[model samples]
Target: MAQQLAQGGLTGAAKLKAVTDLINSLTQDLSTSSLGPRERDAALDELKVYARDPRNADPIFVKEGIETLSKHAFDGSSATTSRNALRCLANCLLVKPSTRNIFVDLGYPEKASIKLTTAGVEDEFLISRIIFLTTYGTSVNLQNLIDQHHLADAILQNLTRHVKLWTGSSGSSFKAASQDPMTDMALTETAKLLFNVTHFCRQKVDSFTPAIALIVTLICQHALPQPKPLDPPLGSLVNALLTLNLASEQGAAALFPKANPAALCERLIQVLDKAVRSYPDRELDTAVLPLITALRKIYELAPAEGVQRVMQAKLLPTTKDRKKVLGKGQSLASLILRHTTNAMAPEFSKAVSHMLFELSDKDATKFVQNVGYGFASGFLFQNNVPVPESVQESFQASEGGRQRAVNAITGQFIDKETAPELPEMTDEEKEREAERLFVLFERLKSTGVMNVENPVARAAREGHLGRDVIDGKDRVEELD
Candidate 1:
């Protein structure tokens, strides 16, 4: 019957008549109590095809057409028939969101959410999407899905099932992808729906805690290369996690267990490294923030061993690169730091800066010492954080008293023999340089960057600035 529209070149009134006749006929057959098994499946399939085309879809919604589709979708006829019915409903909802209310008033969302609890991969994909669509213009209450129908439980269960199916007992690539492509599509649709549910009902995120650890393990176990910034499961997993409180007591337990405290974080660091390498600068501006934020949150609550592992991750500056300038190579830490200074991606840069700062425990001293004053000062100066005098005279060792062979300010190891040498300044040049320094300090003080004393002005006040006036009648505060 659908071939009549295409093969016969039915046009104008002829096409409309043919489509109307097909839909009405299918609707009648599908609604029939005595319809045979094969006839019901064929009718459902034809209705699905009819609903797919916008022009021919009006009759599907004409008179109780959606009602008929909704009945068969979960009417306990047969799995194939139910899935076919679901496709028809999926198409109608996609093409005309206005009919969402029509479907909702029929009370299928509640039924759909329940179906999700036991649905297979295909049904899971279809039902989750159908319920997710009701969230748009319809008056569907997402919290009701959480509080009333236990939708979060279903999402987590499906994610666990996907994990087992994709990776099996061994740590490897998603084997299900080669045998079947629906596995990938199933995850994408399911994740989108999960993001919606959690976004609308944030207070209920505890319901999703178990899935977080599973996602982390899945990401870690995938041995294949992370070839893109937002591949399936990676991007989807991050999206589900973005709203979750990975820092909560429950969340913390799942991530940093006692057996191997830093295992998950170290694994996530590897994932972040791949993302840094895969993402273009424009993509980096938005695609990678959640991953960065997730790592930061976990690190903030990580144990000592975990912290050490995270600091030693490729995302942070290392002494091995202290021979050259920081943020200057294709290494993971360098690429991440390169983004920290990117002007096009200010928020991305800020997140990168925050991640680095957290790795240093947010200490002003460690911040400057680890990344050098040049990098740390930019972050500090941009956010109006006043630098203490101690951060200026950077320490050469970490808190554990491990000394490093790196310049405090430049973050580079100086080979004095090969270092570029310039001539010493003459007396006049020295005086001119002092004057310039005075002017620069004065400007900095004026701008409120720091409430610092102008040493040159203080020198002049105490008569120590080229005036032989160190002797004062009223005692001036001595310069240190």
Candidate 2:
């Protein structure tokens, strides 16, 4: 016969009773100080596992079980115990939103804010997440977090450490490959909390201006690696940027620093390039739009040289690019222009179109000049923008500037491509050509080639040569 329900060790009602009994025993043990540290931690561990399971989750939270978890979550001496306890709490909060009210009533945000002021990487990640959760559906006073706990300053300090670590101002592991995984997680979590606080306290964001520079430096560095559409640090980092004003003077300085503005601008281009190439519209709405919006803001605040890099990297068409259509080429400029017209991603399309207009110096003529009338026209006309009358005249680049016009629909010049067959020459014109061939053969004859024939001499003997010899312009005209 097949094995049936409630037939083996700890099955059905018996197992349920045994688990409840275990929770009862562990709860009573952790509630008291009579148990040794090892015994207490052991009891907390078993109870933590039971709390993770939905069936047994409620039994552990009813009495001293939650208090025990909270007490140990702050245990400074035992790193092992603290991490387990934090994980246990994280699970509880995630599984039951009601647990937030319980944790809030326990007045943990006050303690969390205090610990966050000095928490290390692991503690930072765990505590930041927990407090961030409290931001939702709880009686937690965020204003008190700002005024009393120095929350903004603490986030700024930790973010500054991440920046220093990235920029090599501090820490031995300066590069991403060398960064501690724990530190990376901590930075992401802290940034998420930073977004929450700023989102909740928009009027008080000026307190976070100093943090704007730190985030810029880290983002500029992180973007170089072309991370995933929603990778931790970079993704959270961009969200953090979206909340703060890039127009802040401090943020502007970092984004367009005199030392090397392209360090910021170009790296962001790489990030954007990767985003458009990697994901479709559905994912782009989340993974891509914020980045585009953030980059557009940065560009709006970018300095001349910074704007110059963006133009060169994504707008200006090169001489070699003229032979082919503008957006048809595989260049970055082509890729970006193609997306400017993408219908599926309307917001993305509109954002990019406006950014392109801004980059075009917000003048119709410059827009046509840089991105071409082909790609510029749809956006311009739709917005009731007029194409400058002089756009046609502007298309003629100065001599030695580059190659001239491609198809206007292709954005610029319509090259006069060579014909497949040569045209028939007039008699005089044929004579001029025969004379030039004679000159070439005479030079070859001088070089001691025995078989060389002076076509001019031969043609003259045959009465087929021009009446005059090849010479300068005046004589050549007479010969023709």
Candidate 3:
């Protein structure tokens, strides 16, 4: 019958309609088919030929044929039939637009996706076809699949499994032209597609609550690769993290409350541990901020201050000699002591203190001189934290005055070598450094520090630190 239609004996439209009617009949009685494996194979061969016919390329025939194929793919009794159905779908999709009247008439959306979703088809062949179409097929089909059906989630799940499989079996000399890279790139493209589609979908809703919820979960799971510096960049992970953080901070209250900060912290730690265990030394230089951010988010969620403190004990670095295989060194303890301390978030005090105590005597002193006062200032100013009156008073009454006095105290203890290096003083270097520091000071000024004079302004007032007087105080203040 299909061959007769292909021969063009009857009017093309009429014959195409007839084929569509037969397909619709097949869709209806598909579950009742008791064809044996051999019979199923013969039936699929016929469908495949019909799908390739030029006359059956009309939109109505294509739609009914794809629907029929999807139904047969889902029928579970015949593997050969399902494979043939997918082959037909792929061949038809690969046809030129002029010849694919069915696709053009149907708006070239992911009709297969809609059919699968509406029909609730979970057959592996249909899934594989969906995956191929989304990864390598056109944007029209992908958008339709994502928008008309909840296909993003399905793609994500499939991509995740694919990643595990490909990465697990991969060997050295990895190239996309090779089996591993090709497979991995295909999976990666799937992930990228899902991300782009989800982003577009997010704009339609007031808040991307549902889309973000899935994105966050996926980000927290895979973006942070295990064993630091493993294969991907940490910056890549930040795209997802920062997006989640910004969304939670902005109007996504449901997202924030629903967001599991603690789980996020744990997952980050797993990646960090892998990185630390893999490349310990260099990580302290670059990994500190991200780790701190993760911890801070977790600390934010702790109900009791004491709980935050305890959580710190669990998450904070304890070892001093952690180094990567390359002999590059990262001191988590040093980082914690240097970056998180008094005057800083109190959740970090205990951890910072313990680590500070472990640094080299000279290095410890230098660390204090550079960031110590900043840390002290944080502790001193925070009403939520307690500082001894003796220390506070000592900080307040010194020669340079309270702020300068604290700086002096920290400066006295710091090792010159370990003290954070000020930028080079060459004219060119100084200018760039000045701009950078101005940005930094502006940030500091905006933190609502009372009695806080801008560092550049204070330097100008003292006639010290640099020869040129700091200009644009108001502009700096405006930025602040």
Candidate 4:
């Protein structure tokens, strides 16, 4: 009877209530007897049915079901029993949009919805779920659940301990006797969860610090016995730090007061130097660009201050690290010379030369012509670092890069003079000027030139830049 109803063919509230009542009666009747395996299975089946029915679930009943399932959790017959109860409880908490709204109204933000929905974040439900997945096959994958919950650290703690046991002291014991399938399964699931959590945390800077700290802790714990699987987590941590945003300089100032205007840049410089000196090539390659992009954002916000700090920190490193960074006997000096020719901040412009100084002469010309051109167009010229070099030289190397720099400058580019003198010109001169400006406009578009205020990028990404950009731009632009 419980099986038929638990199957979901009979899910109406009335049917669920009847099954709950029947289970309640059975528990009372069978409380004292030790049922045989078959009979125990029958009792387990009834509870599983009641636990799975959404209408039969409430905070009260679900908590009772979890207790009942825990009694036989290690028993093979009880595995499905515990898993069903968890699923049913999760379903009830997530019952409907209106139900979730009730929790939200009570002060739970959307970020905590998983907890609010279950009313179980503080309860044993989350920990128990982790346990069941770690111990037995309950159909749900443990790692997937961790990523979904944003509980990477919790998951790592479980995986590292389990893996150490399976591969270390327990390895000889298990090998001599026989491998325990259940134990091995638990270890595998924990590993997957660890990997998943690392991947999810990589995409955001705000999430990086906690993720790295957790991964490092886990790796250190399992370092001696297991070394092969450490790469992904370690690489991810490096990438996360390298990607911290400089644009948040103002916010960072609030956190680290001893830091000067360039405090954030200096900290990152220290981090990069440490990484290059101690970390592997794979780590550097994957992390450097993202870190630079983050710094560029900070520089965009406060160019002079940001540039001074980045240069003073001497982040580009000595020519040896630069050679390693630029790759293969490449010329670093000439590249630096060519790239910084038109840079806006003389300090950043000069600092980049250090990167070039590290490259070999054979590759220096191409590097300067290409990569150098690119850095200037995108960071210096396009980002409004300023154009100190001859206009023709800057534009020739990266026509697109130059146009982008021009666009950044022109975004705040008010013609300083009140207005152009209203002197008449020949129709031919006017036509020539329009054509020249038209080419520049096309160049900006083709090269993906953007300004300090990236309306195009914002519009493409968020539909609009949000209230801050729209409202702030209106207010800021009015002063000019």
Candidate 5:
């Protein structure tokens, strides 16, 4: 039968029909009481061979194959057979997008999702393939997965479980083992599937915040480090970052709030910096653009405190010497400016400029001083690609625009206007307060309350030490 299916001179329709008949027969055999597990396994193997053919993507055949495979998939009789069935379905879905609906219609989504929970490496791979394929269709298709099969939740659960398993009790173990090529590849595909789901179903992604956080944490934990000679892989890390960027763009900023923005900014800068250092001459525009975009999104969506934290982090080169060499001692601002000036791709430069513009909006004088006015004017110059008008205006308006330019040209750290000083306690006042505290401590000590040992006594001491200990006791008595 296999020979006949592989034989030449058969029409596509004829081949599909033959494969369909083979699948039907296999399903019948598996259903029979007389067949042993070995026989059933053999039939499933045969089904896998034919079902994987691109010609077998006809909707009717796909539906029939899915129904048969889904039965065995959920039966738990044999992992190998179930996995083969999943592989066949995945292959068909991959070849034909139309089969995705058929897959959902035949209740395969729910079954596939259930399998995802307990799937081993190979089975998980196949199941992920199916989910990834489904993601290629329209948003409506994604909605079906979310609404009917709860695919979003399932994938999140699967990712969380696998990541936990991979990371073990201490996440460092997973990072250490991430260098295994096969494990890395599997995880990469998983991350890709996650990216697709999140990208297609933005409105629904919020509910999966825990899963999103886990993925971000995993990426930040494992990928932020400089790539080892034998790191797990970069694909998952890249995809995870892309997913985060997409989610943030779609108004999901909650996940990033707790992530140390300063550390995150430093990590992103490190990725771009390392890439540029490695390939000094080549155009890494495509490779580094996503990182830059992700950085931009972080700045746009992060809370004020988070954004301030990132701004305070040392992200750019501080010294002119380092800028000349394109060497170490670089700050985030310097990196952005240098890349803006020298980027081979206009889009890359634009991304960096937009980030700079945003930072300028946050503090125009600081941006002007940090990158220097000459570099700032050139970056904000409206030649071919223009900076936001507001950015240009902000620079012009900063320090009435004149002093900032002069200060930038002269390399002066002087600010024309100083921030208002906060009120401070003088030494005399400090000494007086200290003396009062000492007297209060002595009084409390004499009363056998040198420390805050009891809640009532602590409350009384804290409340009354400023007054008299007797008054504190009276207040405590009134409360009692």
Candidate 6:
């Protein structure tokens, strides 16, 4: 029919009018109760083809088509027809940005959320497409989906279903049967949707604790020593970890609240230990960042016992085989420190730094000795890096008081406080010092002893002679 419409002698507006008329006829057929299921399905299939064509993605036709398809998408009589309608609408929404708004304007997320309740495999797949479209379409679209459609509950329900299917009947038979690619795809998309949705609706996310726990359990199960062909793939596990990280960032508690903190920390640390052991070889580097972030957030929110448990898990190995498990000379702390110092991406570096800082606060003396005061001071001096308050308190309370305080201020060893009092300077003395420093700076510039473009050198030269004697006082304070 599309080919016929193109081949016809219609030109300009005539061509568009003909296509619009055809779409109108098809939508009318789809919405008519007189039409049988086969006829309606065929019309939906034809509409999907038209929607797929970029040329036919006109707002008028797409708006009409979305309305028609949304009606059938919610129709309870035939899942096949509803699935076909959903596929068509999804295609139309995928056509253009305007068409996506059209979907939202028609409240398709609400309609799709309802269909997700008892959707079959094919229907669920199509519905997930729409959900992804709305969830990730735009921030406005996503916010609307969350606020108006309650997408969090729908996605959590879907995630919970897949997690149950994968975790149930856990023998070889279950593994074999559960390894279906489609199932994994559905689970992955559902997790992604959950992740995006939770970015906006954190309180609602907290309500889905059971579902979140299931994802964490799946991660632990797959990440722990097991067999080949990780049923859901490592990417899905990473996505799950990222989702939990988002939730934890938004005030959700630890992954397992009621579980024993020591044991939970042991399990979490084991996952990291395994990944670090296989690093640069197993390509687990991608997963390690979020896993570390999730672990850090959990530790932050967990009680004192939980923080202690994490510290214990991250402690240096003593036994021969224990050290071998993390690879020779590789404790979890040292591995994270390596990444903190050397990772190519700055965000990874900051995350590792923050995690280490949190752990350090729990046992400051050990981290200060192991990771070194230099590492902590470097973190403090880095541009825009946030030194956690606990870490600040820890540093202040550590033994090397004055030197550490100076290090915190200037990232160097000194026997002065961070902000020491400066002696009152007489104007005559200040003038003399300013004249002397200015002469020294001029001699250095003449002899090329200092880079002329160096701002620090310029500041040093100007510090004494500047109009504001307060500036000179400030510089003296810095020196102290």
Q: What is the lDDT of candidate 4?
A: 0.38
Worst lDDT run of 10 residues, candidate 6, spans 318-327
- TM-scores, all candidates, are 0.76, 0.75, 0.35, 0.31, 0.62, 0.61
Candidates' C-alpha lDDT:
0.72, 0.70, 0.44, 0.38, 0.57, 0.56
Writing each residue's lDDT as its tens digit, candidate 3 over 1-480 gives 645536334446665675565465556567666456666556555555655655544642446665565556544455556666666565555543332444434443354444433332233334434444434323344455566665654554544444344344324222331343334344343444444444444543322334344433444544444445434433333333333434344324422344453454455555545554564443443444445454454455444444344454444332221111111225433344443543433444444443333221223333333334434445334434343344322122123232223323333311221444565457666566566776787787677764345666666566654445333233333433
- Tell me, by TM-score, which candidate is best: 1
TM-score of 3: 0.35
Off by over 4 Å in 4: 1-9, 13-18, 22-41, 45-157, 165-480
Which sequence of candidate numbers ranks them by TM-score, best first?
1, 2, 5, 6, 3, 4
lDDT of 3: 0.44
Angstrom error of the Cα, residue 440, model 1: value is: 21
User: In candidate 2, what are the lDDT values of residues 426-468, reduced to their tens digit?
Assistant: 7788676776776777677677645555546755786645543
TM for candidate 4 is 0.31
Question: Given candidate 1, what's the lDDT at residue 216?
Answer: 66
**Candidate 3 residue-wise lDDT at 421:** 57
Q: Give model 4's clash tally.
A: 17
Q: Which candidate is the best by lDDT?
A: 1
**Model 3 stretches astray by more than 4 angstroms:** 1-80, 83-109, 115-147, 150-193, 199-202, 205-208, 214-262, 272-328, 332-480
Clashes of each: 0, 6, 17, 17, 8, 0
Task: Report clash pairs, candidate 2.
Answer: 405-413, 405-414, 406-412, 406-413, 406-414, 407-413
lDDT winner between candidates 4 and 5: 5
Against the correct fold, how does model 5 do in TM-score?
Answer: 0.62
Please identify which of the two predictions, 1 or 2, would achieve the higher lDDT against the true structure.
Answer: 1
TM-score preference between candidates 2 and 4, better one: 2
- Arranged by lDDT with the best first, the candidates are 1, 2, 5, 6, 3, 4
RMSD of model 5, in Å? 24.3
Give the alpha carbon lDDT tens digit for every residue of 1-480 in model 5: 543545333436776675666576657755684456677677666655655555543532456766776677666477776776676677667666777877776666666766676666666678877877766653336666667766767666666755675567535467555555555556666777777777777776655555655665555555433542113334355555565433443335434544454555555556666655554434546556666677776666666666645653545334432223222235544555677666476777777766766665545455554555556666545633443334322232233233332234323333432455756656565456546655665576568634423323444467543234322332322121
For candidate 1, what's the RMSD? 8.7
- Candidate with better lDDT, 5 vs 6: 5
